[model samples]
Target chain A: MRKSTIIVLALFAALFLAGISAGEPERVLDQAIRICLSCIGIG
Target chain B: MMERVRRLVQVVFTFLTNGYWAFPFSRNIYQGPLKAICSPGLNCYSCPASTTYCPIGAIQQLMAGLRMSLEMGQLYLGWYVVGSIGVLGGLFGRMVCGWLCPFGMIQELLHRIPGRKFDAIPGLLRYLKFAVLALMVVALPLFAVDEFGAGDPWFCKYLCPAGTLEAGIPMILLQPDLRHTLGWLYVNKIFFLVLFVVWSVFANRPFCRTTCPLGAFYGLFSRVKMVRLSLDEERCTECRACHQVCPMGVRFNENPVDTNCITCLRCQKACPYGAIHLEAGGVRLGARQSRPAQAQSS
Candidate 1:
């Protein structure tokens, strides 16, 4: 793999870990568990 | 053989990612532990059968709540979505589009319906996806807020035919109560859904090439992705065979790492001279296999 690819992957992996540590996954789950009425084009 | 494998993989992933089968009885979306993770493809989280979140939808939600999150001191509200997307991009670039996207598979299947096909996509129009990614998915969600300080998922609301097809249509059909809730926006979304569906029949992956923001995001990592297409320049005779076979209009012999390439490996299969090959981390995949030398001397 190229050095750039490794760097990009590592950087993103760190960000992912940070986001998880910050409880973003739970936040995502909270939003996803509900039926997104707007996504269905409902008012 | 590779095409069959690709199709099988597509089918498997499609079913696996959207496997919440109780929707038929419950008429409700999945509310489970798996909802924490986003699907690698563009499957809508609102789809009753969907087991995971849609990355684009999740990102828009976070972006829409950016101001609110900042005030609440939640700094990494959107980081997971962005990071996951970047990690996917860095690993395989648009390979996810060719091999994993249910919508891309749908478009390909539609294109194969034995109709009058047109492959001549406008060169400049290809960049529209990037614009959609920037404005609809990111900018609008961040900047356009209401009195409650939350913004709408502009791409999901006004665009994203995938959501309309996978979530809107199915949810409304299952739950009759949603029928009265439908209005102009519903019709508007259906129009987009129909437009893309019809366009897919006439062209190859028109949505992926022209307007899919997720595909656009992954395409950004085309040059630096770990798994990529490698072209043997010495073996290539500039016959344009790869160009003719490329569904995304990528001229592989000329620009091996073009952002448009989904790395579907159709070019690799089409190169009778064995000029194109798939590579992972600089090592050629399936190196043990030998390609037919039909056009080697030509």
Candidate 2:
């Protein structure tokens, strides 16, 4: 693999790990559970 | 022969992703762990049978949440959605559009319904998708807040013919209450959907070329994606046959890694010199032989 590609991959991995640690999966679930009226342009 | 295979694969994928066959009146949205994960393509989250979340919708929600967190004195990010998009885009680029997107397949099928075909938009107009990604998906949700500190999903609300087709129409048909609440916005969306359907019959992937923000996002990774189309200059005869078959109108000879190229591999099949092939992680997938000269003459 190219050095640049490797560097980009490592950076993405670090970001992904950081996001996993910080994100509250529960909150995402709460949002996902209900249909957002605005999402369908109803509200 | 290759075209048939592509169409077959598309049909199979469409059926598999949207396999939930319940009564049309049922308003149940699947609330499983799969709903938490993003689908590889642009399936609407509100679709009654959708097994997964739409990545674009998820990201907009996350961005809206970011604005709310600003007032709460804490930060909240939808890292899972971002990571999923990054990983998927980096791996396959816009291959998802060609192979997986139900909407893309729908448009292709619509185009096949014998009509006057023409290029609906200029080549340079393809840049509109990027503006949509930046403004509607990112900026509007981040800044356009409501009294409750939540931002509207602008793209889904105002645009997104897919949402109009999959969710709005179905929900209206199912729920009497929703039908009672119909207004100009709903009518406007329906009008747009009709226009898109008409345009697709005449133009090749007008939405994919001009309006799809997801395609624009994935196209960004085409240059460095792990799996990509590579052209062999030595073997290439510059016959321009690939150009004729490309639905996206990408000039593969000039740039095999053109962001617009959907990696559909039609060009690979069309190449008479056996110059184009798909490569994944440095391994060649196949070397298809060129069609015989007599076949071309015939």
lDDT of 2: 0.79
- The best candidate in terms of DockQ: 1
TM-score: model 1 vs. ground truth: 0.97
After superposition, the stretches of candidate 2 with alpha carbons farther than 4 Å from their true spots are A3-5, B23-26, B70-74, B288-298
Docking class of 2: medium
Backbone steric clashes in candidate 1, count: 0
Model number with the top lDDT: 1
Model 1 RMSD to the real structure? 1.5
Tens digits of per-residue lDDT for model 2, B98-157: 988999999988889985799547967899999999999999998898888788788988
Residues A1-43 of candidate 1 have per-residue lDDT tens digits of: 7899999999999989988988999999999999888887886
Residue A27, candidate 1: Cα error in Å is: 0.4
Question: How does candidate 1 score on lDDT?
Answer: 0.90
